[model samples]
Target: MPPSLKPHLNGWYRSLKATSRSGLRVERATNQPLAALRGALGVAIALFGALALSGPAMATSAALGAQMAGMATFQRSYRPRPWLALATALGLAVSTFVGYVASPWPALFLCVVALWSFGAGLAWVGGQTAGILASMTVAVMLVVVSLTESVSQAAQHAGVIAAGGVIQALLVLVWPVNRWGAHREALAEACASMADYARRLRHDPFAPFDPDPLMAAREAAVVTPGQARSRPAELTGVRPLVERMRPAMSALADPRVGAAEEGPERDRARELLAAAADILDMAAHTIRSGVSPKIPERAYAALALPDDGPILHGIARHTALRLIGLLAEVHDALETPPDDDSPRYLPRPGVRELLPLTVVAIRRNWTWRSAVLRHAVRVAVVVTLAEGIGMALPYGHGYWAAMTAMMVMRPDFSQTYSRGVARLAGTVVGVGVASAVMVAARPAPWVCGALAVVAVGGAYLTMRAGYMALSTLVTVYVVFLLSMDGLTLSRTAAERVGMTLLGGLLAFAAYAVWPTWQTVRLPHRLADQISAAGQYAAATLEAFASPGPVTRRAMRDALLDYRAARAALRAADDSAATEPVRHRGLRPSQLSDARAAVAAIGRTSMLIEAHAPTATAPSPGAAAFAGVVRDQLTIAAVAARTGTKVDLTPVRDAYQLWSDSADGTPDEILRDASILTEAVTGLEESLN
Candidate 1:
């Protein structure tokens, strides 16, 4: 398992592992409470300002304050720029007004929804930051419209919503969280994780190979480069650096490389590995700090291997040299003028270009009919149904039902169902906690407001911890916001609980009506990943033979595509695993085999990528061998896609020929080629 997956896996593992035990233990109290504190402060300020500005319009102010506090959740995760923050807030205010304005008229409501849906689709297709802001805005609007009565009231709500956004914008300006900080941190963290992996591999060459850290680092690297729209050149090398490091790590960690009994040479190799880890740490630190460390001569000196030493020793020596090269690459990346010969820069698309692309996305999804469009339609219908159901109930808050549908209803079955369960449970517990506090001690409105602020912070802080914690905090925040508006406490808890349950049930029903089963998608996703892997492998091997500057961009893009497809396959399998046995698609073993093959391809591709750049004259047999491996990969990919039997004899024969011709091939190159051939051949066998 990749360490990246471990974070999620641990939660499930703990639950299953301790089913017969008494109960799970609390590890320790959290030390970093500043984020929570920041959240609370933002809300408190919004409330204070609302009260100061409009004394009589407390309800409007409460709504505005709540919106401001709610935005904290997004801030904590993304820390978007002030421009983006304001844009999202403005969208939120507009949606809230539209929801209210269209509430009394069904035709108007439909029109507004159609418009919102178009814009939402466009924004969703744009990127995560935009998608999140758009989704949250729509949710807020749905809730507002359902809750508010008249056009006048809706207008008031809109004004206050805008005011709240303005206040938050001011907060952003005053305490400007670095927008690109996460990008820097993610790349740094990836390097750090690689360092850790290297350290582990040094002590035990047979240590379980966990690519999760590297996967996460790659994900972060790709994302951060895109985020640097203003200066794409600065992050150009990040992708290549990660790509280069990945193969080196895999090559070094091969159990066969250093399989011999331990000795003084092994210890010396261990020292080199440890030193390589230090270089990785230095690279990570340099990326984050923008200050290059002086590379010591000892770092290179440590990698010296005696002639005709152990095979493992040679492997360690080669791996150490690669790491040293990577270290120098990192230094150049941080230099005043980068010294890299080839940099992987990404160009940001302008709005004009983006609009067309968005249209294309909508059209493609609409024609091919993907989960995105299905989910969009699902949200629209479910929210409407919840609204009508709420209006029918004697003590219903339509906003609650609509908001629940908006928040909980996902396109995928697993997430939709899981979110519904969590939302329902969290609401119940949160309402209960609020009721207990309010009934036991009837706190003043100001005190309730303060509690609301605190809850907002807690919610933001605990979001990643689990849905239950987040829900509890959010519920408290909402109840406190309502309390400030002089809402009756006697039925508040009951109404909240009932409405939440109703909303959850409705969202589930929406999906159940036209569910997008992961079972149906798993095979397709896996095939896509296989095809992408084939492209990447071909590009990498072709680079070795081309002799000119390889089209690194094509290989990089294919790698990204492969990564995305692989992630999707994993997600689909996870969803399917949680479903009833009857609904499962590929068996566990099949999925496992496919994943192993994909990973094996990645390793082989990396091997090719590592050695391709420095080729003078490709070995006489190397190009022919590469061609054979590439053809086998393509055939394997086709087999994976079409579910056909594979034949790899030709590839095997070619590898044998390459291995037999040992006249002029460098030992290191021969070793890498051997590794690549074995990986490719093994991958084909796995698929078969």
Candidate 2:
């Protein structure tokens, strides 16, 4: 083999292996019995209602609508469950109507499928829930519209489907199984993560922590004005304080910044961390249960500074003091009165307000350079081609092939390929199992309806248990639904399997031809992370120079931006790692070094943030140094993306100036400045 071909072959091998492994992996299912029961009840109600009013044919349509809407309720979104269900239902109804209208003309139907699939792909900009619901709408249209003959019949089917969605929405509103349940879980999980972090820091002061839980909590914070007014006191004013506690805890534990390793100060630090862990656990319980925290007496004692003066001195003492204060504030925040005037951080928009945002999101992804646009085009072409080919083939129910392609394809290579593999395996197993059940029992219509309901409920219960499980259960549900519509089990199973293979293979080929490889975007993502970290560092320094509420708020906002950027970069890197593509801009070593350097810069900023002074005294030359740092990093960010070396002369000069003018600066401020300078120097070396 040629040397050039080796990398490509290796990449393909790795990606294929990952795809197979990921397809087969089943995550542990989350125990949500009430939620599962609620979804099942919704399906049952829809099924029985349609059976009594119309026949099994209309009942199948209703069941599909209810099942899809119920799945929306399980998505990790802050939107109200009823609204999600309604949105999903509306999309399905519109798509079904369009599918039926276009079905008569093969060319026109292909065009309609292309347009709908494109829109579905573009919906990813709104987030995973929107994208999944939109794609499912396409699948629902393709499947449900096949039952109708005339325009009136199509409208009737669409109306019945919409009614099913309405029933699900109504059940969600009236049943109210766990109002604000997701929010509570997110906040509680974040607190518990902090507690765990604190405990870990006792042993490894620099323990790595994933900020995903806190990020989830922040997402959950977005609430409509009405929900904001009625929000639980425990949920408000607690998260911000919790965010501050992390840096403070880290600062106190670090030997370089706080207490000396293996000394009385270290021992004291461990005790305080243990106490903080207990306090955090209590706060998590309070948020989860909406009850007053039962503070441990030992935690209070551990937090109390000795009356004979503090055991730790300087920055370590200050950080410990800050951590203790934050802990107390969190406790108070948890115990806040229902009528407290604490400000809400994220106010969710109403439907009217969200329309413009949605439009803007779509417009942003309209450019040819956008991955979303590429994916949308890919989806349009692939689904249309699948439909065309399926129709050409000597087979019945050509829409199944189109539906398979719609469901399997994604913007990124990993997901599209993995889902294709999973869906194929899942469909085979699901169809086989369902076919066996049908052949053995030969159940009546009502019994088939019951089985469909059970399958849907099982799908809901195992949602977190991987895509393969979801596909399997959904396949079973579809099989049972079609069984009620008088389809021959053996023939249907064979056709279903064949069409799925056709669709899956078509999707895979389409992506191979026009792929959106994450590897190509790595440089841009890295640049973004670097820029965000620089801003965070600059903000932290500015806060040190001018300690005030405004500066502190800026620092907090910068911190959030930095975290988000880092998270995005990490996700991009992980996806790119499994993709069968060549590195485009940065070599592997350069990427690794750049990531390490950026991480170091973030850590330095975090250390400074830990000791953000309460006093309003300005540190000499600190502001100038911050400006230089920010400017240099901005240039470095550009350099990173453009594949050029960064020049750190300006930053080095500014650092020297700051160090020379440090006579009046606080000892801690000077120390942090030196660390920041070293981090910048490391970044320059890494980039070069």
Candidate 3:
């Protein structure tokens, strides 16, 4: 109580507040380091166990686990699911059927090329798809077919792996437990990440973050899955499933959550926060029940879903601080945060410049060229490269190293970069662990199968969550598999290490050779996105004015396209080479602009798709509202510059009119329409 202690007490209190605040920023959304490590360990052990069970089990576990882990966040899209799965099965069957008629290599060579070409659509200008199921399918077919002196024997074995994946998928459908397991994992990760982020932000004051509710919501949605099938367009397996929940997921960024700017921005944030909270409830209900989560009439009604109150607030506060911290890290990282506005986590620049491809056109729509013959030559090229390496190196098995690289090499630098990083890390860790195990208790050859099984499990787990871990587990088990034939563990591990390093280096070189990063002109990309956004915004508003599935789909597609293009432009610019990193790209500033524009568009898109609440627009007059919206867009930009933040007040009359037009409740439409109008208005202001 003495005056002498007052100054010290105040300083201590101040320090405590600062620490807690900063802790909210730097740490990621979760603090599951121990769990992550455990997951990694489980992966290692599973993989080791798979190989020990014999090749059939190994193959089954690898493919099955891969499919399961990959499909965690998938939504139930019955549309293309059966078609894709059946088609994939038929393709494998035909390939296997053919392997019985001829030697595996010649046939596999054709298959691999077909696989490569078939997958080429995934590339974004100058990028080539890598490590597709086609490759694995061909590889498994060839390995099984070639294992025996006779051709029919190989087909039978290869069929086992395919059948395994099918059976596993069927089990997933019948009993959603497996699917939910992954959802649980994802949810835990999201929760932990949030907790961790909050903890970290309390320490670092300059972390970069923004209204990243979409991201957090994504994390939440990722954990709340009904597991859909994989699509070629998605880089991550569960993309479609995750995306279907976007409308609901958007609530994670509830305005109550992320709007950190003062004044109207705060109110806008609160509205969104309230909406997001409702959607989050819907999502939770849907995922937990394995059925759809119907939201209440009131958007923020989810706030009443038990005790998510503090957690939701924590998510918002931590994210705000986290952004500030990321800013500091980025400045320290690449010298600066590319440009002022955060350039998003992933970049995609929409380059519509379609170089007339004799190959692509044939592959996409033309049925004639998507065959075995077209594929053979491609496989031959890869084989020749591998063989050439084999001949060049004193080690007869050096070709395996080349094969490893060939397996990973892709057309895009970004993917290649990611693959290389994952492969490199996986190999090193696998080798290290394998070395340690071998040194501690040298196992028998038969026991090597057990090791292989454990390794495969590790690979399965890591393949989705941690690339490096996958590589490591795969590497160790692969070494064990090779050792089954009396090869020394030390030698095998050594070769694996050497092979992985060589593979990564050579694959990266191939990626660099004619690499297409697709962001050569970012301002153009921004212009394209902005232009499309304007049209899309108009279209979306029009759709809202008169809703239809076709318009909604078009809007979603355009929005997706814009975001992808923006990502490309941002990455290209940031990686701004004095000389292009490989050749074609844009300046980093251009990327920044593209990214910012994308975010603005994305925010607006969320509003467009949002479930509206009641009340009406300020004016039902379209022309007058358009002009007002335009002005708001401008003000929004200025607000961003001035740090006043954009206003998201609803268009009152428009909402009531919309309510009258649609069968939905008037109040809901009124509130949502108003919010969307305001967001669009703010966005338009920013864009101009």
Per-residue CA lDDT of model 2 for 534-624, tens digit only, reads: 8999999999788899999999899899999989899999999889886767888988988888888888899989878767678758788
Instruction: Report, for every candidate in turn, its global Cα lDDT versus the true structure.
Output: 0.64, 0.88, 0.43
TM-score of each: 0.81, 0.96, 0.52
lDDT of 3 by residue, 1-688 (tens): 9997887577435533442332222212321333233333433343344445554334433343333222221223222232333334444455544654554365444444345433433322232212253444443343333333554454544454445445434433443333233343443333233333333333332222232333333433331112222211111222232343333334334442233445543443344344443444444343334443354566534233324333334334443233333322322322221332222222221223234563464457344222223233333355445534543676634545544654554433444456566677667777788778777877766566567656654444444454454556667866665555566667666666776677567655554454444334334445554444445454445444444666567666665555554455455455332212222233344335434544554555554454321233422333244434444444443443333444435433543454556443334334444555554544434433
What is the descending lDDT order? Answer: 2, 1, 3
- RMSD of candidate 3 to the truth, in angstroms, is 16.2
Better-scoring candidate (TM-score), 1 or 2: 2
Local error of candidate 2 at residue 29 (angstroms): 0.9
Runs in model 3 lying further than 4 Å from the true structure = 1-131, 138-146, 163-176, 180-384, 391-399, 435-442, 488-491, 521-524, 540-587, 590-688
Residue clash pairs of candidate 1: none
**Model number with the top lDDT:** 2
